[model samples]
Target: MQDGNTNTPEVETETATDWLTQLKNVIIEYAPAVIAALVILIVGLFVINMVVKLAKRVMEKRGLDATLQKFLGNLLSWTLKILLFVIVASKLGVETTSFAAVIGAAGLAIGLALQGSLSNFAGGVLIMIFKPFKIGDLIEAQGVTGVVKEIQIFTTQLNTPGNKLAIIPNGSLSNGNIINYSAEGILRVDHVIGVSYDADIKQTKEVLMQVMQANDKVLKDPAPTVNVSELADSSVNFAVRPWSTTANYWDVYFKVLEDAKIALDAAGIEIPYPHSVEIHKGE
Candidate 1:
C-alpha cells in the first residue's frame, strides 16, 4: 500500500512538470514577436504623446479658440493611440482584419445607440467652424437666452442675466434659429410710454423728441421716432424707438425712460394708472 501511494505521488508530480515545460516552450517560441510588439506599443505611445503636445502648442500659438484647441488635441491623440494599438496587436500575431471588423461592428452599434450624442458632437464641430457666436456674446437660441461662456464638443454653457448657468445641447442650437444680440454694433430699443387721455399728444411727442435728442448715446441718423401707437381706455400710448450701440443699449434704454418721465412731468403730462369703481346696492 505504501509503494502504490508513492508511485501515485510521483505520477502527479511528473504531469505538473510536463505541463509547465510545454507552457515555457510556447512562450519561448513567440518571445521575439512578443518583445517586438511591446517595444512598438511603448515607442508608438511616446511618439504620439510628443506629436499631440506639439500640435497643441502650435494651436495655442495661433491663438485658436480654447474649446476648439482642446477638442482637436484630444481627437488627434486618441486617433493616433488607437492606430498604434492596432498596429502593435498585428505585430503580435493578432488577426488584424478580424479585429478591425469587430471594432467597426462595435462602433456602429454604439453609434446607433447614442445617435443623439453623436449628432451633438457633429453640431459642435460645425459651430466651432462657423463661429456664429463667441465667448461673452449674448445669444438667444433653443428657447434659452444667455451669455455664451464655454463651448464643448456636445454642449454650450451659458451664464444668464439672472445669474443662472444653463447647458444647451449643440444639436438643438444648430437646428434652431439663433439671435445674437451682440453681433451687430447697434441695437434698437423699443418701448411704449403712456399718458392720460386728456394729455396733449403734440406736446408729449415734442417732449419725447427733445429727451431723445438730449441723450448723445442715441443715434440721430435713424431719427428717433415717437408716434401715437395705441389709444387705450385709460391712456394714450406713444411708441418710442431709439438706436444705440449694443454696449450702451441698456444704459441708454433706462436713461431715456427715466429722462422721458422727468421731461413729461415738467411738460405737465399726466400718466394715468388703472382704477376701478366700487358700487354698493341695497338688497
Candidate 2:
C-alpha cells in the first residue's frame, strides 16, 4: 500500500511537468506575434487620431459645414480603428475570415435595430448634398420658425424668435417644406396705417411716401407704395409697402411706421379711435 501511494504521487508530478512544458511551448511560439500586435495597436491609435485631426483642419480651411466636418471626422476615425483591429487580430493568428463574418453579423443586427437612426442618417446625407438651407438661416419648418443653429445627423437645432431652442428630427425636416426667409437678399415689408374717414386720402398717401423715402434702408428701385386699401367703419386704411435688404428689413419696417405716425400727426391727420353710440327708447 505504501508503494502504491508513492507511485501515484510520482505520476501526478510527471503530468504537471508535461502540462507546463506544453504551455511554455505555446507561449514561446506566440510571444512575438502578440508583441507585434500590441505595438501595431498603439501606433495605429496614435496615427488614427492624427488623421482625424488633419481631416478636421482641412474641412475647416475649406469652409465646410461644421456638422459635416464633425460627422466625417468621427466616421473616418472609427473606420480606421476597426480596420486596424482586424489587422492586429490577423497578426495574432486569428482567423480573419471567421472574424469578419462575425463582424458582419453584428453589423446586420445593429442595422436592423437602428432603422430610425439609419433613416435620419440618410436624411442628413441628403441635406448635405442638396443644401436646401444652411446654418444661421432663418427658416420655418415643422411648425417652428427659427434660425438654424446646427444640422446634426439625427436632428436639427433651431433657435426660435422667443429665445427657445427647438430640436427637430432630420427625417421630417428633409421631407417637409422649409421656407427660408433669408434666401432672398431683399424682402418686402407690409403695413396698414389707418386714418379718420374725414382725413384727406391723398394727403395721407403723400405722408406715407415721404416716410418711406426718408428711410435710407428702403430700396429705391422697387419704390414704395401707399394706396387706399380699405374704407372701414371707423377709419380708412392705407397699405404701406416698402422694400429693404433682408439685413435691414425690421429697421425699415419699424422706422417707417413711427415716422408715418409723426408725419400724419404734424399734418393734423386724425387717427380715429373706436367709438360706440347707444340709444334708449322712452319707457
Candidate 3:
C-alpha cells in the first residue's frame, strides 16, 4: 500500500509537469501572433486617428462647409477604424467574412430604421450641391421665415426675426417652396397714405413724390409712383410705391413715411382719424 501510494503521487506529478510543459509550449507558439494582433489594433487605431485629423485639417483649410467637413471626417474615421478592426481580427485568427456579413446585416437594419433620416441626409447633400440658400440669407420656406444660420445633414437652423432659432428638417426644406427675400438685389416698399377726402388730391400726391425723391436710398430708375388707390369713408387713400436696395428698404420705407407725414402737415393736408357720431332726441 505504501509503495502504491508513492507511485501514484509520482505519476500525478509527472502528469502535472507534462500539462504545464504543453501549456508553455502552446503559449510560446502563439504569443508573437497575439502580441502582433494587439500591436496592429493599437497602431491601426492611432493611424486612423491621424488620418482623420489630417482630413479635417485639409477640409478646414479649403473652407469647406462646417457640417459636411465634420460628417466626412467622422465617416472616414469610422470606416478606417472598422477596416483596421477587421484586419486585427483576421490576424487573431477570427473569421473576417463572417464579421463583414454581420456588419452588413446591421447596416441594413439601421438603414431601414433610419429611412427618414437618410432622406434628410440626401436632401442636405442636394442643398449643399445646388446652394439654393446660404448662411445669412433671409428665407421663407415650409411656413417658416428666418435667416439661415446653419445647414446640417438632417436639419437646417434658422434665426428668426424675433430672435428664435428654428430647426427644420432638410427633407421638408428640399421638398417645399423656398422664397429667398434676399435673392434680388432690390426690394419694393408698398405704403398707403390716407388724407381727408376733401384734401387736395394733386397736392397730396406732390407731397408724397417729394418725400420719395428726398430719400437717397430709393431707386430713381423706377420713378416712385403715387396713385389714388381707394376712396374710403373719410379719407382718400394713395398707394406710394418705391423701389430700393434690399439693405436700405426698411430704412427708406420708414423715412419716407415720416417725411410724407411732415410734408402733409406742413402743406395743411388734413389726415382724418376714425370718428363716431352721437345723436340726442327730445320729446
Better of 2 and 3 by lDDT: 2
Quote each prediction's TM-score.
0.84, 0.80, 0.75
Best by lDDT: 1
Ranking of all candidate structures by their TM-score, best first? 1, 2, 3
- Candidate 3 Cα RMSD after full superposition onto the native fold (Å): 4.0
What is the Cα-based TM-score of model 3? 0.75
Per-residue C-alpha lDDT of model 2 across residues 1-283, encoded as one tens digit per residue: 3554555878899999999999999999999999999999999999999999999999999988777888889889999999999999999989999999999999999999998888888889788767888988888999999888988889889999898999988888899998998898788899999999889988889988999998999999788899999988889999999999877877998899899889999999998887788898999
Q: Taking the tens digit of each residue's C-alpha lDDT, what string does model 1 give over 1-283?
A: 3554555878899999999999999999999999999999889989999999999999999888889999999999999988998999899889999999999999999999999999999999989878999998989998888889999899999998797999999998888899999998788899899999899889999999999999999998778899999999888999999889877788889999999999999988998987789998999
lDDT value, candidate 2, whole model:
0.90
Counting clashing residue pairs in each candidate, in order, gives 0, 0, 0
| Better TM-score candidate (2, 3) | 2
Q: What tens-digit string does per-residue lDDT give for candidate 3 at 1-283?
A: 3554555878899999999999999999989989999999888888888999999999999887777788888889988988998898899889999999999999999999999999899889878777898888889998998989999888999998798999999998998899988887778899998999889999899889988998999999788999999998879999999999867877988999999989999999998997788888887
Looking at model 3, which ten-residue stretch has the lowest summed lDDT?
A: 1-10
For residue 95, model 1's alpha carbon misses the true position, in angstroms, by: 0.6
